[model samples]
Target: MKIYIEDIAKYEGQTITLQAWLYNKRSSGKLHFLQLRDGTGEIQAVVFKGNVSDEVFELSDKITQESSVEVTGTVKKHDRSKIGYEIDATDVKVIGESVDYPITPKEHGTHFLMEHRHLWLRSLRQKAILRIRHRIIKSVRDFFDNKGFTLVDAPIFTPNACEGTTNLFKVDYFDENAYLTQSGQLYMEAAAMAVGKAYCFGPTFRAEKSKTRRHLTEFWMVEPEVAFFDIYDDMDLAEEFVEYIVQEVVKHNREDLEVLERDISKLENIKRPFPRISYDEAIEILKKKGNDTEWGADFGGDEETLISEEFDKPVMIHHYPMAIKAFYMKQEGDKAACVDMIAPEGYGEIIGGGQREEDIEKLKAKIKEQGLPEEVFNWYLDVRRYGSCKHAGFGLGIERTVAWICGLHHVRETIPFPRLMDRLKP
Candidate 1:
């Protein structure tokens, strides 16, 4: 009878056929111990010389690492086994022979592993991280679906850039120029007016030239837009959304957490009502910490770390200078005051959002002030031209949020296939 790797624990004292790849092997004369992995889990199989035929014993002895094989064995309950179950092999047959596997049971550098990512994904650590990433992605959709948010897909190809033209991947669209989307914010806003609340979760491209841990040329972003929502409501939604994702990871990915060696205690304190501070207040704190940051300047990486470390929960830094922000953000008072939120524990700003200027005239003026072509954004400006309300939304980088929850240093490992400035292949 054929059985899966996970079902081996329940089939004790029964004969079963197992198909898997030989992860590792140990042979001591007549006794053989083989660790087999079949994607679901790993199990130890013991093949004694007397328990199997001569052909089976010889095949097990000569089987190379990662060789695909099938074995008929009797399931046995072994209390001393690491995986809580073992298989006593009675018959073994090689299905596919793998000669000179590139990845051995030894350590390799990051560059070398990335070059061999096709096979490196089979390793225990890489497999665990990717599995956790899948869970995170699932939880994101589930959360939004549970809420009344309609899923709206934005276009991958756009006639004009959303942020700026400097970091856009220009492609020829039958004589006209098209660029990949850097954020789905503008599209989601238009959808929100139609659906009340809408979100776009997909790949966003940015042709950034520098190679930084946080910057990726192409990455997944989740942008949610809500009609009739202000900056306060935006922060409330952002906090709750973050808390939901972190709690989901803690509840479902215990085994993965163990593999990553994450200190669960740190994540345990990540509840809602995270610490809130104004941009001006954070600047004062930075200056006290000897950061030398001015009120008009955006928070640097060092300043962000110091501010986030002061609190146990994620910090919500609001009312950033409008002069340094996007043209769409609604200006507060006479000076520059727009809302932004930053996560604690040095994760930096995972969300950038604010109340968009509802008045079409003011928005156009701001666009011109920022030196952006008003003609290219006429479609976006249409949202305000007709029945516009005080609406707000934020863009959350999915990779950054996952990296923070998993306590990973680099964002590349959060995604299965990361496209950085230097890497494009598997």
Candidate 2:
């Protein structure tokens, strides 16, 4: 019967057929050691020359790296194998042949690997990263689902920008221009008014021209919004949300973490009650670290890193300057009631959210002050006019969280087929 490599351990002592690819091959005078990988996992298959027909042995010798084949063999418990299982192959059938694959076992440059990203995903490292990414997404959905948050899907094509037009991707939409959604927080707010607690998870776009490791032209975000919640409630939820997702990934993807060589201890320390410091306190910490930062100045990547280094876990900086924050954020005097969760180990902000302004007049004036077309936000203003209560929400960057969990250097590796500023093919 055809089976996957991940479940081979369950069929021990029984003959099973696995449709796999030859991940690697090494042969002795009497036996051929073939490393095979199917999508689920990898296992070592030993083909004894004396036991199998000469034709089968010859077929094993002719198989090349990444060649698809059906390996009929008896599963055995092998404690020394990487996957804790091995197969004694009695026959080998090549389904397809692969010759001189561009991505070999040896390392290739970033540009070359990216050019061949379609094939580069076959490597174990990439597989492990993507597996963890899947786990992160699952945990995110589960966390919200269990918390009574309804799944609300936001529109991809928006008539206007959520924040500003400078960083939005404007596209021709039939008769007029429409921009790709940059964040689902605005829609989540409307959903919150309807369902009490709501969330939206999907792709987001940014047209900023940045070449930094943290920048990506397209990425995914999971935003949660709740009615009758204030800024402090938002911070509490953010703290619990971050802690849960981190621990969930660590719990379920331990093997993947091991494959990535991530420091499990670092992630284990990601508990709730994360350090919450006001923007003023963060400025003090940065100043102590010899940063030339001053009050009311927005923190850049370098300043964020310096501030986050003060704590071992994620640090939440709240009460940012009103002038720098989005107009939707509620303001107290000169500070907006917003927060940014900066990840440890130099990973910058992974979440940005806060109490949304619910006052209709204030919201309208803020929208006009930001040079936004008030008519475009009439429906949003109606949210306040019809029935509006205190509400808050936050948007978490999925790629940055994955990169931090996997201890990756760039956000590009966190997602499959990442869209960047310059590269687009494959």
Please give the CA lDDT of all the candidate structures. 0.85, 0.92
Q: Candidates' TM-scores?
A: 0.96, 0.98
Give stretches of model 1 more than 4 Å off. 334-339
* Weakest ten-residue segment in model 1 by summed lDDT: 334-343
Q: Candidate 2: lDDT over CA atoms?
A: 0.92
Which residue runs of candidate 2 sit more than 4 Å off their true CA positions? none
Error of 1 at 101 (Å): 1.2
